[model samples]
Target: MSIPTTAFLALALQSQAAAPAPAVAPGTIAVEVAEDASAFDRLFTDAVTRALSDARFVPLPLESHSRYIARVTVTRTESGAVTAKAKEPPAMAALGQVFVPLPSGKSQIRGLVSTDLSVDILLRGGDTPVWSGRASTVQVEGSAADAPAAVATKLASALMRQFPRRDPVSVP
Candidate 1:
């Protein structure tokens, strides 16, 4: 059965600066991924490199030594038999559904996964990250071919929207 379903694209972004730091001036940045990166990770890195380039930062080849390095990691967490509770409509908020504890949901939804992306920018020899950001989203898991490209591209673009600029906000 072909089900026409929309991909959930609610992305949450959190970024922080390492102490009082200097603004990142446009310069060459080397993108690095885990040595044994999976297909999804490779695709995500490529997309992020493009995003960095679009932001006026030159992305150097992975092997090339550069003053700045953009180390990124991507992870997907999946769970079987998910239970999602329905939220009351805005008009029903005054009826106390929003405040009162709702009963357990009876239906079990499957195949949903949470994808997380984290990027850390650091100096060549620095042990601590000079800047960092994380983005996360949940969507139905697609086949190998479609998921990596679609999800990686969209996630990379969204995460890079605040590169090097958004002042660090304390995340609890």
Candidate 2:
């Protein structure tokens, strides 16, 4: 090949390598949140439903059937590492102790709850998940972050942001 033609082919290949993976075809998806008989189940279900809708996914009722199933699971830890800092609530403004500066020049804030939220999409009758994503963080204490509704909304939104997309295609 001529030098110019070879360079053109190399540039085209590089651009293709940098492109993101194609998202799963838009279609109906059944959303189901593992029930623990608590208010959180309902809140998470509603949050997931809203997020799916926002992502252009047709979330089906639990009783209905669909080819894709989005399963949500929540795991709350009794305590987690306090490595990351969180923002304090308005009520704590008067305390003037919201953030503690560390020797490393990082500020640390108190957290009331730490949880892990995950969503796994699977094909019907499939044993392995086709796509999965997880969100984990310690919510700021005394702030809106501690509210269950807020937590559900935040986690669901974060998790679904990358939904329906297969892992990136690595160029050899």
Superposed on all Cα atoms, model 1 deviates from the true structure by an RMSD in Å of: 20.2
What pairs collide in candidate 1? none
TM-score against native, each model: 0.64, 0.61
Give the distance in Å from residue 33's predicted Cα in candidate 2 to where it truly belongs: 3.6
Model 2 agreement with the true structure over 1-172: per-residue lDDT tens digits: 9999999999999999998644466568888765565787778778877887888888887677777788877777645434453343322123375654334444474545676777777776776777777777676555566677888888777767766553321111
**lDDT of each residue in 5-53, candidate 1, tens digit only:** 2222212112233335766776888998888988778999998899888
Q: Model 1 segments beyond 4 Å from truth?
A: 1-19, 79-108, 143-146, 165-172
Candidate 2: regions farther than 4 A off: 1-23, 34-36, 80-111, 165-172
> Per-prediction RMSD in angstroms?
20.2, 10.5
How does residue 133 of candidate 2 score in lDDT?
73
Model 1 TM-score, all chains together: 0.64
